[model samples]
Target chain A: MLKKETYINGFSSINPIKDSGNEEDVFRCVEPDYKTYIDTIAVRRLGKIQRMALVGAKMCLENAGVNLPDAIITGTGLGCLSDTEKFLGNMLDDESGLHSPTSFIQSTHNTISGQIAIMLKCYGYNNTYSHRGLSFERALEDASLLLLENTENVMIGAVDEIPDSTLKITQKVKTFYSKSHRNEPVAGEGVHYFLLSNAKQPNSILLKEFSSIEGKVSYEEILLECKRILLSAGIETREVDALILGTNPNIDELHYQQLQNELFLNSNVLQFKNLTGESFTASGFGVVLACKFLLGQTLDERMYLKKKHSKAQTVLIYNQFKGISHSFFLLQNV
Target chain B: MPSKVYVTGLGIISAMGVGVSETLRSFSTEKTFVRHPEILKTLLKEQYPLGEVRFSNEELKSLLKINSKQSFSRTSLLALIAAKEALFSSRQKESPLGIGVISGTSVGGMDKGEYLYDGYIRKNGKFNLHDAFVHDCGDSTNKIVSYLGTQAYSTTISTACSSAANAIMLGARLIKAGKLQRVIAGGTDALTRFTLSGFRSLMILSDEYCKPFDQNRKGLNLGEGAGYIVLESEEILNKENRKPICELTGYANTCDAFHQTASSPDGNGAWLAISQALALAGLNAEEISYVNTHGTATPNNDLSESMAMKRVFGEKMPPFSSTKSFTGHTLGAAGGIEAVFSALSIRDKIIFPNLHFQDKMEETGIQPTTDFKKEVEIKHVLSNSFGFGGNNSSLVFSAC
Candidate 1:
C-alpha cells in the first residue's frame, strides 16, 4: 500500500495571552473579548474549558478556510474542570440536593469533542483523548492516521482550563507551585487547534513522523528509536536544527535539564511551558510554538528557556505528562 | 491501495460470561442478561433494571491480581480483565513486539470517586490521592497498559459509545501505516451511580429489559462489561504463521453534530459512518451478512439507527440485531463488546438474536433477527455504535 503524506495546513490557539489574532501579536497578554464570540447566556452555561475550546476551534477553522471538517478530535487532561469542580463541590456543599444536571453533563471528558461536532454540524469522526499530558499528542496521532488513510480534512486540538477547585487540588497535590513563582510554575488554561490534510500547501508544515513511548524505557533507548525513525525518514542527527522541549520551571525543569544535558546537548533547545503554563495538554501548545519557530516567527521572551537559534530546518517536539506518557513528533518546514 | 488489518484474538467479560465461549453459548441460548440490579448498590435498583456483571470489586481485583493497594475502579478492573484475556488469547510469548493497547472508556474512575467523594472533601477519607488518580478517563487505559506489562504505543480513546470502535480504528490504522506490528484494541466501562443517575436524568433508562427496534421501546437498560481484540499487521501474522479469526475489513467514524445528547432525526452521522465503512470494505451493503446495530433500545437511537440502516442497506438490509439487550448499553465498551461478538459471529457462522423485540418499529420497517441462527456461511458483519454528542462509528468484520 502506498502511504499518504500528511501535513499541517493551518493552526490557531487561544491562551490567557492575546495570541489568536496576528502572528506578531502573540506576545501581548491582555483580556480577550469573550463577549464577542460568547453571549452572557452561553457564557454563564459554559465551563472555562468549553469557552476556550470553542473560541480556539472557531479560529482554527476560520484560519484553515475549512467550513466543515471531516472529523473533530480533541484532547484534554481534566476535562471541563470548572463543571466537574462545580458538581463535586455542590455535592460536598449541599449534600447533592438541588444540584443541576448541566454541570454533571458538561463534566464528561468527551463533552468538548461532542460540542465541536455539534457546532460544526460535522457528521464525521469525533473523538477525545484525555491521557494526562500526552492527550493532545495522541489526538494529533489519530488525526495523522486518518489523514494517512486519505481522509482529507481534520480538525484536531487540545484544551485545558484552570478552575479554582482544580487549582486548589493541584496545589494540594504539589502539581502547582506558589503564585510568586509564576514565571516558572503553575498550570493555566489554553486551547490549540490544527487543520490537518494529506495534501501539502505552500504555507503548510510537513509532519514527517510521530511516536509514543511508554513505561521505563531508558533515554538512550528512546534516542536510538528516534534515531531509527529519523534514519528511516532519510535524515541524520546533525541535520536536525532545533528541538522544542515542553519544560516547566517548577516541575519539569529537572527532566528538561537532563534532556538538554544528555541527548539534546548539541541541538538548539527551546521551551514553551513558561508562556502556556503547565496544563496537562500544554504539549499541544509546544507543538504550536515549534511550528511558529519553524515558520521564522518570534515568540514572547517569557517562554524562552534557551537562546533562539536562527534558520532551523527540522524541529523535534518532545513532551511527556508527569513522566508517564511520552510523545515525540518530527516536523519540517515546507 | 488500502492496507489490510487482521483480527487475531478476542476477549470479553460481560453479564453473560467471562470468555468468548460463555458469551457465545449465552447468545445461542437466547439468554438475556438484563435483570434487577444486584451488583450495583443503588436506591434505584428496585425501580430500574440493569445489566450488572456479577463480580465484586475485590473479586475482580483478585482475579486480575492487582496489588497496588489503591482501590481500582470498576472500569479499570473490567478493562484489565478483558485486556489480559486478549493478550493471553493472542498467544504471543514476546514481551513487546511494538504492540500497543488502545482502550476506550467514558467513566474512568467515577465509581471510586463517587464512593469516596465526601470523604476526600472532609479530609478524613481512607482514599489515597492515587486512588482518585483513575478518575480521569485516560487513567483506565494507562492502568490497562501497566497491567499488561507491555508498553509500546498505548493511548485511550473517549468518544462515548463509539469509543472502542474508534480504538479499533486507530489500532488498524497504526498497523496499516506500518507504525506498529500489533495492538490490543477495545474499551471497558463499568456502570456507576454517576452514569446511572445521568441516564435517569435524561429519562433514557428502561425499567425493564430493552427492546431494540420494537415499536413500544421505552429506553435502554445500562450494563457494564469490557471487550478487546488483538489486531496485527498481515506481515506479523504471516511471520508468526498464525491463523486469523477474522479480518477487520473496514471501519469509519463520523460525528452527527446534530445535538449534544441526541442523534439527529435523520441519522446523518450514522448514515455517513455506515456508508464509509462499507465503501472502505469495498463491498456493497447487500454483501453484509449481519449488522450489530448500536440499538441501545432508546427511542431516539432505534429510530435514527433504523433510518440510517435503511439509507445504507436500502430495501434489502441484511440480518441485523442489537446485542445491547444481552449486555445492556455498556457505553464506551459497547463497541468493543459488539466487535468481539461480530468476530465470534463470523468465526462460529452463527447469528445472535436480539433478546427483547416484540414488534417492528413504526418509523422504519426494520425488524431485527429475533431468533438464534446457526451454521450460516457468514461472510461479512457490520457493527454500529453511536454515542452522546452525535459521535457515530461503524466497523466491518469478515472471515479471514
Candidate 2:
C-alpha cells in the first residue's frame, strides 16, 4: 500500500560463497582483497568485522555511482562477534582492565553502520536493526519509508559475523551443520549492502513489494500473506516466473514446500541457503540474488531445484525460519 | 487520509519501582533511587553506582507466571514486565486491527551471553544452546509476541540510547501512514559485566551519583530497565472511547556524524533533531512547556546538549531538567523511559526536579529546575535522547 517505488541501484554480497576461491558444492565466500579497498590507517584501526563492512559498503557505493548517501541503515543479529568474544574472554580469564579500545568499540551492533557513516563523513540519518531473521527486512522497510518521505538516496547494510565459539555452542545442539557433515543447514556470515533510490533507472529493478508478519501465524496465514503480496503487485500467482524460497533445508519441514506446490504449482522453485549458507540477515543475499536474476534474465541450473524457467521476468522471495518471522518479497525487472 | 497518533497507555519499570502508580508515587516524593547496585552481577560493584531494578529474575518470572526454567534473559524479563503493564493499562491487548512491536535494545541478552562466553574461555565441556538463542536482540521481542498474542509486524532497533525514541517514531509513522493501526513501541536493556567493562574501558563511568547539567559533572552511571508505550490511531481511540495519556505530536532523529563516542561541541545534530521535531508538531520554541534533556552528566553530552537547547530556544528557553539524575543513564531504554516521564509531566501538570544540581555551567545562561517542584498549565513537553554514533532523536508530547 505504498505510493512510491524503491529502486535497487547497486549492491554487493561478501559471503562464503563469493569468497570461495573455487566452485565447490559447499558454500563459502572468497573474500575480496581488503588491502585494495581500505587505506592503511583504517586497516590498522579496524578488526576483521569492520574491514568486511567497510569493503562491502564501498563496493556498493562505487557500483551505485554515489559519493555520500542521505542515510545509512544496517541489520545485524550478533554484530562483530569475534571482537565481542575477544573482549569477553579477557573478562572471564581474570585479566580485567587490560585491553585495547578497538575490540570494545567494534563490539556494538551499530558499529558496522556507524563506522560506515563515519568513513563516508555522512551526517545524515543512521540506524541499525538487530532483530533475528527480520533484521534485513526491517532495514529495507525503513528505507522504503524514507523514500516515501522524499529522501533521495539511502544505503542499507546487513552484516553478521559468526565466531568459532558461537558455532561450537550452536553446533553442539545440532542447530547448525558443518561443511563435511552436509545433512543439516550450516551457519554462515556475510556483509551485504545496497544503495537505493526512489527514481527508476535503466538497470534498476523495481522493488515492487516487501512484507513481513510475525507472532501466532499459521501456515495458512503465511500462504494468505503471500497471496496478498502478489495481489497487491498486480501479478497473478501463475505469472510469477520463479519462486525463490529461503529455507533451512530441513527435510522434515514440508510446510514451505507444501504451501509452494499448492500456490505456485507450475512456477520453477529455487532455494538460496545452499549457496549463501545461513545467517540472520541472509535475506539480504536472497533479495540481491533475485534482483541479479531479474536483471540478467537468466539462471544457473545448479542453484535451482527445478530448472524449467530459463528467464525470470519476476521473482518472488519467500523466507521464514523455524516458523517464526515470515517475510515475502516481490521483485520485477523495470 | 492519515489519522493522528495517540498514546493510549504507558508501562514502565525502573529502579524507582514497578507499574505506573509506583513510579509516579516515587516521583512525587523526594525519593530518587541512585546508589551502588544491589542487583547487577558486575565485578565492578565497588567501583561504579547504578540505578538497577530491584526484582530478581525468578520474581519477574513468577509475576508473569512463566516457568523459571525457560531460557529467559533478564532483558526479556524486564521487557515483558513493562510491556504487559502497558497492554493491560491501555486495554488494547486484544486489538482487532492488529498490533506491531518495535522494541529497542543495545546488547539484547548480553548478560546471558557473557556467561556463555565464560564457558567458552574456561573450556567447560557443557554448553547450552538455549543461552545462545537468548542472546539475540530479537529473542526478547519474539518472547513478547508469544505473550502478547497476535501481532501484525515485529522488529528491533539498536541505535544505542536513541533506539527507543526511534522505535516510538516508527510506531507513530506507521499509524500516520496507515500501515499499522496500533503498535507497542519502546526499548529495554539489562546491565551486564560486558557492557559495564566496555564503559569502564572508555573511562566514562562515574564513581559518585551522576549530576546532570551541573558544573561539577564527571561522567555517566549505566543503569538497566525497560519502558514501553502503547500507540493507537485516532479511530481506535474513538472506537474504544479511550482517553490518551498525551498526544505524540512530533519526533525527529539526526546524527552528529562527528565521532563514534564523543558528541560534537556545536551540538549541530541535537539542534537539527529538536528543530525538526518542533517542525513536525507545528509548534514554536515558545510553546514548549518543559524540556526533558538527555543530560547524562558526562562533560561532552551536557555541554553539547546545552548548546543545542540554546540554538533551538534562543533566549526563551523552557524550564528543562534531566531525569537521568533520578535514573542512571539507561542507554537504549533512556528514550523510552524519558518519554514516559514526559507523558507523566503532561498528565500530572508538573515538572519533576533534576537532582544533585548545585551549579550551572558557564556556557550561556541555562539552569535546571534547582528544586523539586510542581508547575501548572504545562501544555507540551519535549524530551531529548542522544546516543553514540551521533544518533540523536527528540520527541514532543502534548496534552489533548
Candidate 3:
C-alpha cells in the first residue's frame, strides 16, 4: 500500500473489440486514424503496437489536462512481437547480407516507453516492465512508489501485440489450454494507458489499493487473497458494489463462479474480456472498466454475470492468469 | 528515514569465470577472456571475437543439477546458476518468504527462440518441446524463483543493455519502500545469432578485443553471462547478524530522449544520471574513489561518456576503468556484472584495470587507470550503464 493518496486522473484504451453491443472475438486492435496523432511519415515506420501506444498515451495526457508527466513507465509482455519476428526472419533468410536496423531498434521492449518520452521530450524517470502477467501491476507498483515520493503525475501503460504467426502457433499448440479444462478465450492484444496523480482531479477515482502474487495458487488461496485485499482497503464484502472478475470464455470458470457465489454474493459480478478478449495485460482493460464504473458509467449488459440492486461506486477487480499470476485492484468513487 | 539497502552477497558468471572467487582471480591476474565463440554455435563464430562462457548447455545443466530433459533456455540456465549461488551465500539460519526476485535481460530466450522460430513459423519442421517454452523475459525470473524455493514477488525488466542497472535500482527502491526484506537483483543474457547479426548489421562490432577509452578503439566484443547480488534491508541485516558487503547509497535512471541506438554527443542523460546519483548519496565528486564506466569501447559511447564524466567531475575526475575489456560487453548483464565488480573493489580495496589501453582519446583527453592497483583506500564506487533506447543508469556503492 502507498503512504500517500493516488488517483486515476485519466485513462484511455485501444482494444480489438469492434463494438460493446455484441460478443465478438476480435483478435487485433481496432486502430484509430494514426494521422490525427502521429504525422504521416512517422506513422509509416512505427509498428502497430507503437502507433497504438503513442495514440493512447497522447489521449490519456489530453484527458488529464497535463502536458508532460514526471515519469513514463510502460509494461509489455511480448513487446513489438511483429518487429521481433520480422528481424529474426530477415536475419534467418539473409544469413550474411546486411539487415535493416529499423526492425531491430523497434523490437526492444523499452521502445514503447522510450518513444513516448522522446515524443514528449520529457526526460524524467523512465522504466519498462516485461514480466508475463504482472507486467502492468509492476508498472503500477512503481508509479505508486513515485506518488508516495510526491511525484505529481505519472504516465503509465501496458501493451502487448500478438502477430498472426504467434497467434497461430499458440492456438495450434494449445498453449492457453489446461489439460482438464477447455480454453474459450481468443488470443487478443491492445494498449491501455493511465495518468496517475497524487492530487485529486474532478474526474479522479481513488485508487485504494492493488496487490499481486505469483505461484501455483489454489482457488481457496485466491479467495482468501481477495478478502485480504478488501480488508486492507477497509471495505467489507457487502460494501463492494461491483466485483469485476477477469473471466474469459475459459471452461474453468470454477474460480470465478465460486468466488461470486461465496465471497461477494451480494455484489454485482461482471466480466470485461467479453469485449477486450484475453491477453497477458488484459487486466489493464479491467482496470479501465473499474475506473469508468466508479465514474458512474452505466453497466454494459454484455458484461454482466449477476446484476444486483446496487450502485457502481466501489469496484474490486480480481484476475488470475492460468492459475499462476493472481492480482487484484480496489477503486472507490471519491 | 528510509531503510538502507545493503549488498549481502554476490554471484557472477561471465567469460571471467563462474563465481566470485574465479571472477576476482581473473581480474587480479589481468587475463582477458576475449576469444572466438566455442559454446555458442553461430555462423560468425570464427569471424568475430567474443567472450563466450566456456561451458556447453549439457555441461551447465549437469553442473546446476537440472534435469536435462526439461527444456530451459541458455538465459534461464545462466540465471539459475548465478541466482543459486547468491541465495546460498545469503542464507542465514532459516530461509524466509517475501524475497523478491528482479532480473533484467535484453534477449530473454532468443537463444532458444531463434532456433525454434523456423520450425514453428514455417510448419516445415518439428518443434521440440524443450526449446519451445521459455521464450519470454519473465521465464528466466520464474526459473530463478522456483529454483530458489521462494514464493516471492518477481519481475523482469528489459531496457536493453542498461537492464541490469535498472533492476538493481528497482531492488534498492523496493527495500527502501519496506516492500521486501531481501531481494536478488541483477541481469542475465545468452549469446545468440540474433544479437550477433544485429550488431553485425550495425557495423559496430569489433573484430579485435575492445579498447575502451582508447584513441584507436574498435567496437565491443559481445559477451554472454549472468550477474546477481543479494540486497537486504537494514532491519534484516540487524536480525540476521550478517555482515554486509557494502551499502547501496544511491541510484538514478534517466533517458537521453535523443536517439534509439546512439547517445548524444554531450551525454546529457549520462550527466543527469551521475549528478542525481551523487546528490542522492550526499557525496561530492571528490568523495568517489573509482568509476566503472559503461564503456562498450564503441567510438560514440566512450567519447560521450568521457564528456559526461568531465562535466560531472571536471579536473577532479576519479580513476575510472571499463571492465568490459575483461568480460566483453555482456549487454544487459554488463550492469550487474559491473556492480558486483564495484562491490568487490570496495570490499577488497583494489581497483581493476582497463585492458589493452594504448592511447588517450583526443576528443576529451581522458585517461583511465591502465594497471591493476591494490591496497587503495577505496570508499565509494560509481558504476554507469547506458543502453539502447537512450536508457542511462548510474549506481553508487559505498564501503560499509
Candidate 4:
C-alpha cells in the first residue's frame, strides 16, 4: 500500500511554564496570568483544568494560523480533576441537596475536546483519549490515521491540569510527591498542539512514522522496531544525529538510562523532563522540545543531559507514559 | 477506493434488555423501558426517569464472577459483560486474526472516582490507591481487553455521545487499512449522579418518557448501558467462511463547533457528516432504507437533526426514527447501541418504532416511524450520533 506523507506544519503549547514562540527562553517557575485570558466571573465557574485547556487550545490555533481544523482530537490522563473532586466532594458532603451542575458537567473526560471544537466552530471529527500515559500518543495515532485516510488539516493535542484536591488525594495515597519531595519538584499544567497535514510545508518537520507498544520490550527488541521505522524512512541509525528521551527524574531515569545505553551508544543523548515536571501528556511537550532541537536551537541547561552536541540532523523521540504505553517517532529536518 | 468492513456479531445490555435477543424482543413488542431510576441510588430517583439496566453493582459483579474486593465502576462491569457476550457470539475466540478492542466511554469509572475521592482526601476514610486507577477512561478499555485475553490493538475514544460511533468508525478504518483483521468496537456508560445532576442543571432532563420530534418534547432522559460489535475484514470472513450480519459500508465524523453543549441551528456539521458518509458509500440519500437519527429528544437535538435530514434528503427522506425513546440517551454508548440496532434492522428486515411521538415540531415536518414494521427490505441503514461540542458522526450499514 502506498503511504501518504504527513508533516507537522505548526506547533503551540501553554503550560505552567511560558507560552510557545520563545524557544531559547526558559522559566524555572510560571505564574500564569489567568485573569488576562479568562473573565473574573467566568473564572469563578471555570476549574483549573478547563481554564488550562481553553487557554492552551486558543494559543495552539493562534500559532497554527488555523481558524478551524478538519478535526479536533485531544488526550488527557485525568479529565477535569478539579471538577471531579468538587462534584464528588459535594456528593459525599450532602447527598440530597441540589449540587452545582458546573463541576459535574465539566468532569466528563471529553469536555476539553468538546470545548476545543466549540471554540473553533470546527464541526469536524472531535474525539478524546484518556489512557493514563498513552493518552496523547493514542490521540496522535488517531490523527495519523485520519491523515492516512486522506483527511486533511487536523489539530491534535494533549492537555493535563493539576488540581489541589487531586494533589492532596494523591499525597494521602502516597501516589504523589511527598512533603520531603515537594520542594524537589512541582506538578504543572501543559497543553501541546500540533497542526498535522498530509502536504509538507516549508520549514516543517516530516513526521515519518509513529508506533505504540505495550509491555516491557527488551532494548534489542525496541531497537529492532526503531530500525524498521528508520529503514522505512530510508535512513540509517548512524545517520541520526540526536536522540531526545522523555526522561522524568522521578520515574523514567532508569529506563531512559538503559534505553539510551542500547540505542544511543554512540549518538548524543538529550533529556528534557527536568525542565518540565512529569504529567500524563508531558511527552507532547518533549516532542515540541525535540522539534526545537532539530531546528538548530540551543538547548537550555535544564534540558541538557550531555554537553554541547553537533547540530541535530535527524531526531528520534521515544516516550512511555507509565512504563506501559511506549511510543517511538522518527522526525527529519526539511 | 473504499474498504469493506463487516459486522459479524452484536451485543448490548440496556434498559430494554440484557442481550441481543432480549433487546430485539422488547423492540418488536414496542416496549418502552424508560422508568424511574431503580438500580442507581440518587436523590432525584423519584423525580427523574432514566433508562437504567436494572441491576445493582453487587448483582452485576456477581454475574460477571468478579470477586475483587475493589469496586468495579458500573461502567466497567457493564462493558465487560457486553464485550464478553460479543466475543462469545462471534465464536472467533482462539482465532489469531489480530483482534483489537476499541471502546468509547465518557465518564469511565467516575462512579468509583466519586466514591473514593472523599475517602482519599480524608485521612479518617479508608482509601485504596487502586481505586484511582479507574480515574482513567482507558482503564475500562484496558480491563475489557484483559478480560478478552487478546491484545492485537486496543484504544478508547471519548467524544461525548458520539464516542462509540467514532470507535466503530476507527475500527472499520483499521480493518480497511489492514492494521487489524478483527476488532471489538463499542462503548459503555453507567448512570451516575454526576451526569444526572449535570443534565438536570442543563434543564434537559425529562420527568416522563422522552418524546423526540414532538412539539411538546421536553428533553432527554439519561440512560446507562453497554454495546459492542465484532467487526471483521472481508478477507478474514472469506478465509474462515464466517457469516456476516451486516456490512459497515461507510462512516464520516465532523464537528459542529456550534456550542459547548448545543448543536448548530442549521446542523451544518451534521449535514457534512451525512453527506460524506453517503459519498464514501457511493450512494445517494435516497438509497438509504432507514436512518437511526441521533434524536436525544432535546428541543435542540431533534430540531437540529431534523433540519439536517431535510437538507440531505430534500423532499424524499427515508423512513427514520429515534430509538432513544426505547433506551434513552446512552451517551458514549449510544453510538454503539444504535449501531447494533441498525444492524438488527438490516438483518431482521424491521424498523424499530420511535415511541412517544405526539405532535410534529413546527420547524421541521419530519415525523419518525412510530410503529414497528416487518418484512421491510432494509438495504442500507444510516445511523447518526451527535454529541456535546458539535461532534457529529454518521455510519452507513448495508445488509450482507
Candidate 5:
C-alpha cells in the first residue's frame, strides 16, 4: 500500500478496436499520426511500439497538464518485438556476425521509457519492468512508491506489441482462450499511459489500492483475497458499484462468471478483453476504463456482461492470465 | 527510524569462478580469466575474448542436481544455482513462505531461444515445444521462484546493464516500506550469439583483455553468469537473531537522457546517482572507502565516469577500481556480480585489484588500485552499474 494517496490524473491508450469497424476477429491498433507527437525525422527511425508509446504518453501528459514528470516508469512483456526479431533474423541469415547495430540498440526492454525521457529531456528516475502478466501492475506499484517518496508527478505506462512473426510463433506455442467460447479472443497489442500524482486534483480518480498473486491459486482463494483487500480499504464487496473483469467470450472465465453470478449480482458486470483482445499487459486497458467509469463515463453496450442500472462510484478491476497470475485494482470517484 | 535493509547472504558465479571462495581467490591471486571461448559456439569465438563461466548447460544442470530430462535455459540454471547458494547462506531453517524474488536480465533465455528459433526457422532441426516457452524475460525469474518451491511474489527488471542494480534497489525499497520482510534480488545472463553478435556489431567487443580506465582502452570483453544476495529487513533480522554480512545503506537510479546507446560526455546521470546515493546514506564523500567503478574500458565510458568521479571526489580521491577488469562486463548481471563483490569487500576488509592497467587516462589523469589489499578499515563501498538507455544506478554497502 502507498504511504500517500495516489490519484490518476490523466490516462490515454491506443488499442486495436477503436475505429477499425472491420467486423473481423483480426486485431491491430488504430495507430495515430506519429509526426503529431514525435519529431518527423525521428518517427521514421522509431519502432512501432516506440511510436505508439510516445503518442499515448504525450497525450496523457497533456491531459494531466504536466510537461515533464518527476519519474518515468514503463512495463512491457515483449519489448520492441519487431526490432528483436529483426536483429535475430538477420543474424540467423548471415551467420557472419551482426550487421547493423540499430535494431539491437532499440531492442532492450527499457528503450521505451528511455526514449520518452530523452524526448522530454526529463533526467529523472527511469525504470522498466518486464514481468509477464504482472508487468503493468509492477509499474503501477513503482509509480505509487515514487509518489510516496515525494515525487510530485510520475509518468507510468504499459506497452506491448505483437509482430506477425511473434504472433505466429506464440500461437503455435500458447493457448489464450478456450474453444467453446462464442467469440475467440485473438491476440492484441496496445499502449496505455497514465499520469499519477500524490496531490489530488479537481477531477482526480482516486486509486484506492491494488494487490496481486502468482502461482496456482484457487478461484475461491482469489475471491477471499479480493475480499481481504477490499476490507483493508474499509469497503465491502457489496458496495462495489461495478466489477470490471478481464473476462472475454473466450475461456471458462475461470470462476469470474461465478463471481459475477454469486457476488455482484446487483452490480454492473463489465468486460474489456472482448474489445482489446488478449495480451499480457491488456489489463492496463481495464485500469483506463475503470477510471472512465469512475468519472461518470458509461459503459459501451458491447462491454456489458450484466447491466445493473446505477451510477458507479466505486469500481473493482480484476484480471487473471490463464489462472497463473491474478491482480485486482480498486478505484473510487471521490 | 526507518527499517534498515541488510545483506544477510551473497551468491555469485562469474568468470572469476563459481561461488564466493573461488571469486575471492581469483582476486587475491591476481589471475585474469578472460580467454578464448570454449563453450559458447559462436561464429566469432576466435575473434573476441570472453569471461564465460567454465561450465556447459548439462554440466551446470548436473551440478545443481536438476533433472536431466528437463529443458532449462542456461540463464535460468545460472540464476537457480546462485539463488540457492544465497538462500543457503542466509541460513533459513525452512522454506520462506513470504519471500520475494526479483531478478534482472537483458536477455532472459536467449541462449536456448536463439538455437531453438534458429532451428525452427531453418526447418532442419527439431523444435521442442517446451523450449519455446522460455523466450520471455520473465522466464528466468519464474524458474527461480518455482525451483525454490516458495509461494513467492516475483518480477523481472530489464534495464540492460544496470538491471540487477535496480533489482537490489527495488528490493531494499520494498523491505523498507514493509511490503516484504525478505527478498532474493540479483540478475543472470548466459552467453549467446545474439548478445555476442550485438556487441560485435556495435564494435565494442574487445579482442584483448579489457583494461578499464586505461589510456588506450579499446572495449569490454563480454561475460556471463549470475549473482544474487539475500536482503532482509531489520525486523526479520531481529526476530531471527541472524548475523548480517553488510547493510544496504543507500541506493539511487538516474537516467542520462542523453542518448539511447552512448553516455553523456559529462556522465551527468552517473554523478547524480552516486551523489544522491551517498546523500541517502547521510555520509560525506570522504566516508566512502572504496568505489567499484562502472568502467567498461570503452574510451567513452572511462572518460565520462572519470569526469563524474572528479566532480564527486576532486583531489584526495579514494581508491577505486573496476572489477570488470576481471569479470569481463557481464551486461545485465554486472550489477549483481559487482554487488556481491562489494559485499565481499566489506565483509573481508579488502580491495580487489584492477588488472591489465598500464597508463592512466590523459583526460582526468586518474588511475585505479592495481594491487589487492586486505585488512583495511573499510566502512563503506559504492558500486556503479551503468547501462544502455542511459540508465545509471549506484548502491552503497556499509559495514555494521
Candidate 6:
C-alpha cells in the first residue's frame, strides 16, 4: 500500500431539511444559490438532482480554488428518480417504444458524473457507483486510491433524490414507512461533493480510513473491522472524541445504538440520519456533518445525542442500511 | 514497485452460449446468436434483434440449483452462473488473505423490478414488496457473493457501458493497494423492458445485426449476459500454484467531457484512455499485439473509436476486431467479455474477427479484421469500452 495521506480540501452539500415552516421548502434544498452556480439557459433543461450535483461540484471546486480536478467520480443510490419516473410513466402510458430521449438520458446512473465532466471539460478518470449504501463509500475509496496512485486532485460526490412517486413507493414499503413516529428519519434527498487532494493544505481534514462490510454482518464483525482500522492508524478506541451514528428510530436505529454502546461507550455520540433522512447515500450527508463537527463548530441541539465533548480531535462515522450492510469511516482534524 | 494483478480465471455466458468453452466455440465456429429474444418480454422484440442469453430465468435457476421458493432475478441468476465458473476455474479453496467482489451493471434486476413495479402501479395483482427492495444494483453483487459462500467486501459499479472495465480497474487498484489478495470482478445485466425501451427511445437500436466500422453501419443491437474474471495478486497466484491466464497490466478511464449521448468528433476520451493505458503498462502503442475495440457498430461510436485508434496507432496499428459484432453490444458486460476475449487472444495467439465489415469509414479509413479467425503471434492486447455521458475506459492484457 502506498499509505499516502489524503485530505479533503473543500466540501459542499445540497441536502433537504425536515422543516422550514412552509410547505414547498419542507423537502427541497435550502442551501446553494443554484442560479449562481448554474447558468440561466442550462438550468432550465436540468432536473433538480442534476442541478444540485452541478452546483455542488462547482462549489466544491471553487472552495478548493481549483478549476478542474484530475478526476470526477460520483455515486447515486436512487439515481435521478424524478426523470426516471417521468420516462417510466410515459412508457406506461404509451408503449410505442418512442419518447423524447432527454428524460431517458438523464436517468442513467452515470449522468451526474458525466454532466460534471462536460461542465468542467475534465477528460480524466470518471466513474459512478450505485451500490446502495456502499455507493458513496466506493466513490470515496476510488478517490483515495487515485490520490494514492499519484493523481493530484479528485472530486467525489454522492447524490440521491426522492421524487414524489418514488417516495410514495418507499413509504409504502415497510422499512421506510412509519406512521406512528412523525418526526422519524424518512425519505429525503441530498447531493454532497468533496474535493480531495494528495497534497495537504492548511486546515484540511485528513481522511484516515473508509471501509464497508456487506450482507448480514454481525456485531462482532463490525467491532473487529473498526478495531482493524483504528489499529492500522495507530489510534486507540479511547482517543476518538466523537462518534457519528446512523440512528433512525423508525428503522435500523437499534443496530447503530448497539454498535455505539458496545464499541464507543461513553463517547460524545452524535446522530446525523435524523436530520439527513434515509436516502441510500445518507452516509455522505452524515460524513459532511461529521466534517462540520470536527471543524470545531458547536453542535445543533438536535444533532447532539450525548453531551458535547470539548476539544475534539478524531471522529468516526458509521452507517448501514436496514442492518444488512455497515460502513465505517474515521476522520481526524489536520 | 507496484504489485502486479493476474487474471487466473474467466467465465462468461452470453448469446454465444454458456461457460468459457461455449463462448470459445462461438468464436471458433463463427456463430450468429442475435435474434428475437424468447427471454425478454418486450413489445419491441419483433422490431429489434437482441443478444439474449438462451436460457430462461427458471431454467437458469435450476441450473444453479437454486430453489424455486427463493426469488432470483434473471440478472442475478446469470451473474451467479458465470461467477461460479470463474471461482471454480480460479481453483482456490479458501480466502486466506480475504477476498472481495466488485460488479458492474447498467440495469440490475430491472427485469424483475419492472414487472413488480407494474403490478404496484397498475394494481394488477399482488407484488412481492420484498423483491422490489432487492432490485438495486448492489443486490446482484450481494446475491453472487452469497452464492460463492464468502464474506468479503462487495460493491457495484454502474458507469453504463464502461462499468465492467471500471470494475476490473478498481479490482486491480485494490490488489495494488494491498487491500485484498483475491477479487472477483466483472459485470452482469439482463434484457429488460426498461432498457429496451430506453435504448429504443435513444433511437440507436438496430433492427438488424450490428456491423462494426462499416461505412453503411446502421446501429448497435443491445445485448444481455454476464462475464466475470477472477483477479488475484501475484502472491495469491504463487500460493495457489496455478498458472495465470494473463496479467492485467494496464487500465485507464477518461471521460470525453464532450456530450452526454455522443462521443466527441476528436475522440479525445478514447485516445487519452488508449494512450494512458499503454503508458501505464510501460509499453509503446506498437507493442500492443491485438486491440479489442468497443465497436458497438453505432455510427457515432465506430467513427469516434476509429479516429481514436488512428490517433494512437497511426500506420503501425496491429490486428484489431470488435467482438460485439459477434455477441452484440453487451452494455455493462462488454468490457468484461472483451477482456475475456483479449486474454483468450494472448493465451491462444488467435485474433477473433469482426463479423460484418464491407467498407471502412471514409474519414478514418481504418479497417477492422474481417476474417473468421486469424492466427497471430500475440503477446499483449488492448480493449476499449465507451458509454453514454462520454465515459470511456481501456484495458491492456498481456501473456503471463
Location of the lowest summed lDDT over 10 successive residues in candidate 5 chain A? A175-184
What order do you get sorting by lDDT, best first?
A: 5, 3, 6, 2, 4, 1
State the displacement of the C-alpha of residue B225, model 1, in Å, after optimal TM-score superposition: 0.7
- The better candidate by lDDT, 1 or 4, is 4
Candidate 4 local lDDT, A140-188, one digit each (tens):
8888888987778888887877666666655555444556444222454
Residue A9 displacement in candidate 1 (angstroms)? 2.5
TM-score of each: 0.91, 0.94, 0.97, 0.93, 0.97, 0.95
State which candidate, 4 or 5, has the greater DockQ: 5
Worst 10 residues of 1 chain B by lDDT: B118-127
lDDT of 5 by residue, B275-311 (tens): 9999999989999999999989988888889899999
iRMS, candidate 3, in Å: value is 1.1
Model 4 segments beyond 4 Å from truth?
Answer: A18-48, A90-95, A180-186, A216-220, A251-253, B69-71, B93-97, B122-124
DockQ of each: 0.48, 0.60, 0.71, 0.57, 0.76, 0.69
Pairwise TM-score winner, candidates 4 and 5:
5
lDDT scores of the candidates, listed in order: 0.79, 0.82, 0.87, 0.80, 0.87, 0.83
Q: lDDT score, residue A300, model 5?
A: 73
Estimate the overall C-alpha local distance difference test score of candidate 3: 0.87
| Lowest lDDT block of 10, candidate 3 chain B | B89-98
Give fnat, all candidates: 0.61, 0.58, 0.62, 0.69, 0.73, 0.69
Badly placed stretches (over 4 Å) of model 2 are A18-28, A95-98, A178-183, A215-219, A248-253, A259-268, A297-301, B93-97
For model 4, the TM-score of its B chain against the native B chain is 0.97
Quote the chain B TM-score of every prediction: 0.97, 0.97, 0.98, 0.97, 0.98, 0.97
**TM match of model 1 to true structure:** 0.91
| Full candidate order by DockQ, most accurate first | 5, 3, 6, 2, 4, 1
Candidate 6 residue-wise lDDT, A30-140, digit = tens: 556877887848657767788889999998899888899999989888777787777777776776658887888888789999998998889999999888877898888
Model 6 earns a TM-score of: 0.95
DockQ of 2: 0.60
Off by over 4 Å in 5: A20-26, A176-184, B122-125
The A-chain TM-scores of all the candidates are 0.86, 0.92, 0.94, 0.86, 0.94, 0.92
